[model samples]
Target: MILYTPLANTDIFPADNAVFTKRHCVSYQNKQFFVEETDKGDFQVLQLLSTDPQDFLRQEFNPGTIIKEH
Candidate 1:
């Protein structure tokens, strides 16, 4: 089946409530990041919410990169 709506996929088919529980908004390096808790107790970068373009260029903030707590 094809979906033609301009709305986002999540908006069309809402995600599981448990999925949101794993996600968190964290501040790292003075930047806000949307991260998800991993099985290893590390946070994985989901989305980078920053106004600076340079933040996007940083590999550390890239999606899928795991952020381990020191």
Candidate 2:
């Protein structure tokens, strides 16, 4: 899946066999982030997986997140 967050200008492409479960977490730039798959075949960055200090602030891309087509 190609998931993008405009606020962060970040794109995440999961592998073909990448399994996305409620417990799945992605580590980007040393910070962990959660993933949630929507009913429409899009994914959501649920929230920051860690509560510790990080270089960047975590942005929430709730309902209006966009899916990019390749």
Candidate 3:
């Protein structure tokens, strides 16, 4: 089996109205990505990376569950 590492903390995700927060997003290699909202709800995803995280990054708050990174 082959395991892949995610490029987290990289300047790949973009911030937009769709995104709840648009605070600290940077640009690199002429690419942009964002934590997007899909029909399935919110997902912390990259711009165009086929690689999936080894495991999901999630957190629990008073409101409920929030995926910190995935």
Best by lDDT: 1
Q: Write the per-residue lDDT of candidate 3 for residues 1-70, one digit (tens) a residue.
A: 5545575533345454445553233232332333344445444344332233422332221122222432
Instruction: Indicate whether candidate 2 or candidate 3 has the larger lDDT.
Output: 2
Displacement of residue 7 (Cα, Å) in model 3 is 22
Residue pairs with clashing backbones, model 2? none
> What lDDT is reached at residue 58 by model 2?
33
Task: Count the clashes in each prediction.
Answer: 0, 0, 3
Q: For candidate 2, lDDT tens digit of each residue in 1-70? A: 6655664432344553445453345554565656666566555565655666552343443323332211
Judged by lDDT relative to the true structure, which candidate is superior, 1 or 2? 1
Model 2 stretches astray by more than 4 angstroms: 1-23, 38-43, 53-70
Predicted model with the maximum TM-score: 1
Clashing pairs in 3: 12-33, 13-33, 14-33
Error in Å for residue 60 of model 1: 1.0
lDDT of residue 38 for candidate 3:
44
What's the lDDT for residue 68 in model 1? Answer: 88
> Which 10-residue window in model 3 sums to the lowest lDDT?
58-67
Error of 3 at 23 (Å): 13
Residue ranges of candidate 1 with Cα displaced over 4 Å: 1-5, 8-15
lDDT by residue (tens digit), candidate 1, 1-70: 9978889998677777788889999988888999999988999999999889988999989999999876
Report lDDT per candidate.
0.90, 0.49, 0.35
